[model samples]
Target: MRAVTANALCAGQTRPGSGGRTRVLRLLLTLCALTALFAPATPARAADTTPAQAADTAPPSQAAYFADRLRENPVYVTDQLPREVPRATAPDFARIAKKTGVPTYVLVLPMQSSTGGKELLGAVHDRLGRDGLYVLIEGTDVAQATAYGVRAPADAAATVALYELPYDAGPLRSFERFAEVIAQGGEKAADRAEAARAKSEDDEPAEMYIGPSDRSNQSLLTGTLLTGVPLLIMLSAGYVRRRRRRSGAERRLPRWVVPGTAALTATAIALTAPVVFDQTRSSAARTPSPADLSARVERVAAGLKQDPVYADPESPRVLDARQVDRLHDRIRDFRRSDGGGPVYVSLVPQTPESESAGDPDLFAAAVHAKVGVDGVYVVADPADGTIDVYNHGLRLDSNHLFLDLPDSVAYGDSKADRADDHLLGERLDALMTFLDETPRTDRPGSESAPAPAPRAADEHTLPPLFATDFWPGLFVGAFLALLLSGIAAGLTWIVGALLRRRSATPQSPASAPASASASVSASNLRRTAHAELTSLIGEFTEPSNDEPDDHGEHGRAWDCLDAAMLLVEGDPGRTRERDTDPATLVTVIVLARAGRAALAGEATEQCCGVNPLHGPAVGRRHVRVSREGNRRRMLPVCDPCRDTAVAEPGGIPDRLLKLPGLESGGSRLPYYEATDGPLSAVPDGIARLIDKVRETAGVH
Candidate 1:
């Protein structure tokens, strides 16, 4: 049959649609035959039996008939049976019993493949001897299987099965049901047994239970409550001190220095106090044993082992002792690690328990030993009953480390009266002391030890660059250079301006006589010149009668006189030399005055008698001059004669007007012969001279 099945499977692969149909037909035929072989028989006599007979007589026997068929068939007995079925003997049962701690009631059903008919009977004997509840049964029997909702052929291999019993009972109840079902020979028999068991136990309740006192809970409370008070006090004190310091700084210090110095001092006091106190506390605390640490390690290991995260088959978690050792080693290093340098450390309680203890000593010590440095600190984890170690490195003057231990360690508790308040204060004090005193080289021995020699100075040093001397000097030098440069530039500009002004201004000539004065003579020649010029030019007409003739001869004469007066005004540049040309100016003035006197109907002889060309007359009288070789010879004339000459209608002779060298036509005189010429001739000469003067003055 196997060879035919293999050949047909091969044929199905070789041929497409036809072979697949043939294979399906073959499968159907095989299924039908197996179904027929395992089919249950209907009892013919059971239907015919009367209710009274059914109750009295045993049910018609399908089991016996099936047993007869199985015994009759050699193939069923040999090929269908297991080569080595499990036994219900003492040793075999004991082995299974040790592996699973369940009682025999639960064990017997799963051990049914060894003995076919006598298995249950033998199991009952073994279990009864051991004081167990029941024996094994045909776990796959029709009635037994149907009760548990499982189905298998009578000759099928035995298999273990589980079921959720009624009333939420466990595996023990299911096993008891299996055993009772087979013994009582009915589906409802196991239910009766379960009911009886439940009833027997119902009167008594399970024992009331209590668990052990929590050591971690006590530790937590002690740690927190003890530390909280001191921590609060210390923080409060520090805060008050800072306030005092700030007030002091404001009152005492200069405006510029207040901010920096006050901040620095406050921060220094705050940060340093806690670290120093922590150090002292750490030294004071008791040290725990290595055995205690080992136990803790084991507990942690056990927790990790039970967690599915670590036990999962696909991805397992791993840990090593070295990693733990390194962590402790780092902490130990921190306990000893310190310097009077900028960096400092502080310890604060991190949980209510830690704060309650009023001491960080134990925690600090553990962290110190673990980290090997004084900078290491311990804080508590409130969520998990564990202490956290911290390694803090901050500038020595930082307020960040001046934490209130109670506040810091009490999770989120902000209350002042927490149990761990005192611990916070104490820890702060210890931390401050530690920070103040601990040396730089004193760290964990396990870590790379600091070199013996102090650190070498590099090629560059920051100190000099930021030194007090350097900045002040640099600033002073820069300021002086800038100030002096500005001053010098300004001075140079002023000096240059002065020199330019001096060079541009005109200077008096060095050769000029300083004390020399020139003589000026007053004369009436200008009047005569004015009169002549006005008669020749005629009178000017005005556009309006109210408007005077501003452009007339008199106006012209006034303007000229005013211009001359301006030249004589006190100008710094004007000098006596410019105004002292007496001969020409006096002649012009005298002629102008003479002409004005003539026009005013004054005696012509009196006005014309004053000649600026001649000196003052002898005896306070007038002097007459006659032309002689281009020079004038003076003749003594009486005052009446001068007056008569001025009063006459034609005061001067016309021949006198034609005086030699004074006439408009050319004329000359002999020096010897003209010594004492006529008065008329001299008068005419004077008039002509005056007319010549007026013409030269640009009057007419």
Candidate 2:
């Protein structure tokens, strides 16, 4: 019967695309599905359950199975079993276990229940029936070790590794650290644990402490931005408005324009003032009543009972994220050690509501009374980075807590210079280490230590970063913004009134000197050029009642005029010296002159070589110039400029328009020859002079 069944299975596997083989596979699958539906739950089915439920359901059966596998190979990893630890982790476990010397078995599996520790180790040892060390690792978080009939201090070594290392130290590192402790075996291992803990504490970077200088700098920056930024923006807006009005037909705004803008700016500042500044009750007036203090203590005690670290959410954040984590880690380490009771830490701002007495020790005692537990109670005032410790009932040598404060807390200068959030945590961590190492007496109160001296307040007038006045700086900023805005609006109104009066009173050409107009500042040159351009626009755009003799002449004149208008109109207000402003102004002058000449039935000529702003050329002459390789060419020259060019050595004209050099004052070539301005593309009079040279020479 066995031979017939084996031959039939072999025939199904060997035949390709056979109907019999397909039917046999389908029948086997159907049988599996039916068996799973009707039969009792198996190990495969139990794998889908939660770790806690699976742990509680069948520990003995699972242990027996794993023990048998361990007997074959100490590092047992199964594909049939579900585990958080990767299959690749088996080699690493095998290597670590081999080095331990003692008969060691490490089981890396997914067992997240509380009893997955010692209980599971016990069951596995019972089944394996070996006098050896057994380790159970749960995912990458928990690790438990047990030695049956062996000399390893499994519990003590595990505890030292668990709490001494950082909270985020993974399972492998924990196991490695645990193995090291086991190898040492006794009191030397305990000393090694203390050294590791001390090193970890020393290695952590201290949190940044905001000091008096930081507060002052912050205030100065905030004030300047709030006041200066708005003032500059408003002034720029006014300048832009004035420029636009001067450039266009409309030169004056409505009477309400300036006043209304000022009013709106003031209203905005008023609306934002409350939100910008701190609106909480003044710290000076924060003395809480007896009822409030008791209520606060009761709430703190309740929180401390659940978790050792109790920080009031309503208070200012004194303990940052890292400080809080370190505090919790230190508490856990202390709890796991012998001769130490529960530790309750309260981090609160020094307020009447939070503290009954002004002192931290008194406040801690009050909290301890409500807690109704015999343990160490710690009260910290994070506002000034101060703390006090109290011992209610712990079987240690000392009833009084002796704290060796850090230099920052001990000295006045360092304390004033640096105010750290980690100060409280550091002090608490030191206290915990001291409590753990201190030898216990036979009975409570058998030994008493001297009380440490009270810590002195730093002799600095500048308030800590937390307690700085937020309202004063904002108030000053709003006042300045309002004052400056009003002054600006008043000045605008005054200037407008003066200009309106001047327009009403007409001035003849005799009253306004040509010299006065010629001596205009560089800033006002754009406005002067704008006025001349406007007149030129009117001449070309406005229709003439008298019909012209030549229609083509008028058309040509209008074309030149249009080109000049486009040049002047391009990107107004970008009047940088190196920008297109100089080119645009000169081009407008040259084009306007050509239009006037075209209208008069005269041939248009190139602008003078000395200055394009000198209008049309009288004639052309060959003037040797070193800028053009000392070559002489027929160049346009105005009458006065022509005479000046003749006077200069080599007849080289000193051109009026010169662009800035790469590093020094001005370029070696004239502005038009440089081919670096907006007018280079446009066929203006000066540009036409260098057209062939620029195109053939590749100057552009």
Candidate 3:
């Protein structure tokens, strides 16, 4: 059977090995085939080419071509002739004309000489008749000569220009070219002239191109309707849509999303609010009627002249009637031309003293009146001879008036010449004449309409609803909610865990049967309690008494008492008689003697006890006693001790009595009996005796 089993095992192993080898060989062959199939093909090599040959065949880059073309040209310079004579004469012109085969033309320009002299009298008339070269003399300054590049000698009297015109040029073209040469230098003359002409054409003031009144109105209406209505509607719709979307989103999302969404909504509202506010403001600023404007202007004009307007306390100054009239005219003209808008006027006073205050002669004044009125109105800075014309409650311009007085009147300390008075009189007469010509009108009551109180900033309309307080409150609430929920969940989990552990725990086997197990457990508990009590006694004992006294009585007594108590109390089934046999009694007596010896500070015998065989028998009882001198003070014994019927009375017996045992009776009590005498009458009398000895000996 072993051989058969061995053969079967060998067959199984051999078959698996042979089959595995065959599979491995197949896999290797397949891998080799795959590797061959997937191998990369070799790349074809490229033909070599030289840099120079390649560059020659390749097209030039745009930048390189441009550079080559730029390098092929040489720089050229040309000079142009002037059309007019220079303020000073030119000496290089002749040499230049001869070298270039261009005839020279001389132009003599006039000058304002400090010495009175006649103007130029055809000084180059003979030279102008030349066919190829013409000399033209015209009044010119240094600017004209400089413009033509005509360099003249410092002492020369005239400038000369040489021209070479094309043969087919007409007179007009010739003159135009001549002017061109005078305007710019030779090479760029034609280009400069063309540029200047184009610029002039471009710069020419365009006529106010107003469409037909009806057509303009219609176009404006259409544009306003198309743009304004759609824009307003779109903006309003966008605002509503955004607000609604944000509100919906806020309701759906968590608290954190609300702040950012509210911010965005507020920004949108803020942006659109300005446009609405501006529309209202513009409506408020619309121009009043022309009649109202004219009346306002007249009232403002009247206020300007006799209002005793004060310019400054140090220097007395007021607007003259002429200035007021001029201001009225400017206002009327502006109203007629520009409709109604805000205008600013400046009054320039010429006074040496006023000029010294670091203040300019120009003083600005404003009037909130309308245009096309003759009356004077008192406006800002009415003390100065500055009258501001206003159109539609907006300032237009200021009319300034300068004071003119006789030199004697202005500067009384200085001598006055007749010529000075004539000049002053002429100025004053002009002023008075202007004042006389000024038209007057009644003051308009509506002109002084108080400006509406400025509206408060819109932001202060209501306390910010979306204040920092709002978000923080929400955040705190949410955080508190989350925190409370987490705490509750944690508490629940802990309670559940504790409950599970409590449920899973098994009861301790009903504490076994209280006979053998309980006795043993009780004995162990008593031992532990005795040990703890002994330790407490030790702790209470003085450190100075670590070594036993000369008698060693207290230490010996304590040791005996502890041992005896441990034996009696530690055994739950033992009767008290056995606990206090004769040997035990002798030990307690000896302990009492030891205690007396310790109190007397003398040596005494150390008390000792041991268990013995049967002796006197007595019933179980508790006894207690107190020690006095060498005797114990006993307490009353239990009834069980006196009752002869009770077995083991007092739970101890006298040591001299014999018991029915095989061995001779020892000088100790039987295990189950009590003591017979009144000495053992008290309950726990021996224990009480030991305790009294311990207390007297100060052994705790």
Candidate 4:
């Protein structure tokens, strides 16, 4: 009609004569004004309809439809139901209801309606307006029943039926079990229920019902084992090393000991980890709190800001590419329409954190608060094909939409009606159409909607990604074990090296001075002492055939050489501990030199004051040694050392043996300055050397 009016106005304006155009235009304007005045306003929404009128006009709800059907037959079974409810099982249900001796109404549907099974049962009972037992068996393995003015133990019968039948038992079998309890009176059913409860109690593992205190105790124990085992292994190794060190043995563990112990600790922790993290304890109803909700809302809001359709792939319910394209197109169409701000269609799952918070309106409000934009939000739980629609800027009444929409699209249809993917798309389309029809209430972003109240705080904290999972935990533990093993091995190597050096050198109460040259290998010194002792022994062994009275001196010389050899070569037969210390080796050399003097008839008591390993002293000199501070002492020295000391009056020569400190590890000093044994005492007399060899060789 508007097009014809427009064409008529245009044709009138094109008239050749000015006078004719003026008349035609005035007439066309008058016709257009009449047409505008006569057009009616857009149709009234159902919200505006009176309750009586709405009741007269609105189609029957599923609960009412089922109730109406139950008026004709006691057993109502849909052609399509959950696998747990076998097909064509209406007769079996009817038979069970007849045996109960009272009117029993059973409704078996494939899935739950928008209203839950309990609510449906109540609604159906009210609508039927009869006294009987009402039962509803729906998909998702839910069963609900109630009795109105009936004498049956509903709770006991239900409990008995649930406990007696397997979870996967067909609805007919469950109903039969339920009927059996009803046929037997309340007392009998109660008894059966109690026995079934006892059996279930026996079947349940005690670990399943572990309390918070018990769980905490278990966690504490597990943590202790995880950390304490490794620490204990390290402590044990240290203890073993300490005992050996005190026993005059090497203070180091074997190469594989530390690492092997660490590996065993990690293995024990890994094997027992399941006790702490019981995945079976995780409840499906575990929902996220308000803090967790904020993150998910913000993520969706951010995505929606970029693209209207937020299809989360990680969600249990993911939209296919085709469904995404369709949703995207629908959103574009919504935006192009009047009163449209933005259309956000989210295909996200009912995550554990948000599972119990299934209110799409709450989710929509949260997304809007985050997005800071007025829009139509559609949140779908693809797991069960449940979709929710919320309008922020538009004047759409959600109650009216519910009233107007078909049962199949409004409440997701049964699996037989449509596949989940198509069902979601169809619901979205219905919401869009409803949004287009509703009048505008407010402008987009003009006023902000309040955010939804967050869920209560949950007792359990959300586990970090892969934190409690067996494989991931094991992988992390193994990696940690490897790291600990490397550290242990490295420490073992460093400690072993320090101990070997400490054992190989001499240990004394006093520290070695800086001037000592203790770098000479103790083994080399022992070999040299061994050679000298052997030569001296051979010399004394000749027995001097020309003088038999020379036996006493020769016997003394042989005794000193034999004792010196014992000091150089440790008594491996008695104890494996080597006696070839650097200071001990120096003492052995002194002994050998003293024995040589005994053989030559020019026996001298003193050796070099600077280094006894330089052989026996020939004379004495007044020189300042670093070990004696500024005091000058007449120290006995060898011929070469004496010559050097006399030539350089300012300082002593640098031929002192720098042995390890007599106080602790890593410290060093001159042998004569630090040691109080053969090296220090022998410069005054060969008596200390003789006693040391005699004691070491077990000689009187």
Best by TM-score: 4
In angstroms, give how far residue 285 of model 2 lies from its true place.
56
Residue range with the least summed lDDT across 10 consecutive positions in model 4: 507-516
Lowest lDDT sum, 10 consecutive residues, model 1, at 74-83
lDDT of 4 by residue, 174-223 (tens): 67788889889989999999999888876731322333444454554455
TM-score of 4: 0.32
Q: What lDDT is reached at residue 199 by model 3?
A: 58
Write one digit per residue (lDDT tens) for candidate 3, span 306-387: 2322222111123333343444454445334432322233222222112111122211212222223333232232122222
Candidate 2 TM-score, C-alpha based:
0.25
Residue 72 alpha-carbon offset, candidate 1, angstroms: 99
Which parts of model 3 are misplaced by more than 4 Å? 1-322, 338-700
Relative to the true structure, candidate 1 has a C-alpha RMSD (angstroms) of 43.3
**Global Cα lDDT for candidate 3:** 0.31
TM-scores for all candidates? 0.14, 0.25, 0.15, 0.32
Clashes of 2: 0
User: Best candidate per lDDT, number?
Assistant: 4
> What is the C-alpha local distance difference test score of candidate 2?
0.55
Give the distance in Å from residue 253's predicted Cα in candidate 4 to where it truly belongs: 7.9
Position 526, candidate 2: lDDT: 54
Q: Over the stretch 125-209, how does candidate 2's per-residue lDDT look in tens digits?
A: 8888998888876544337788888777777677677666655354566677777788887687677767766766667423223
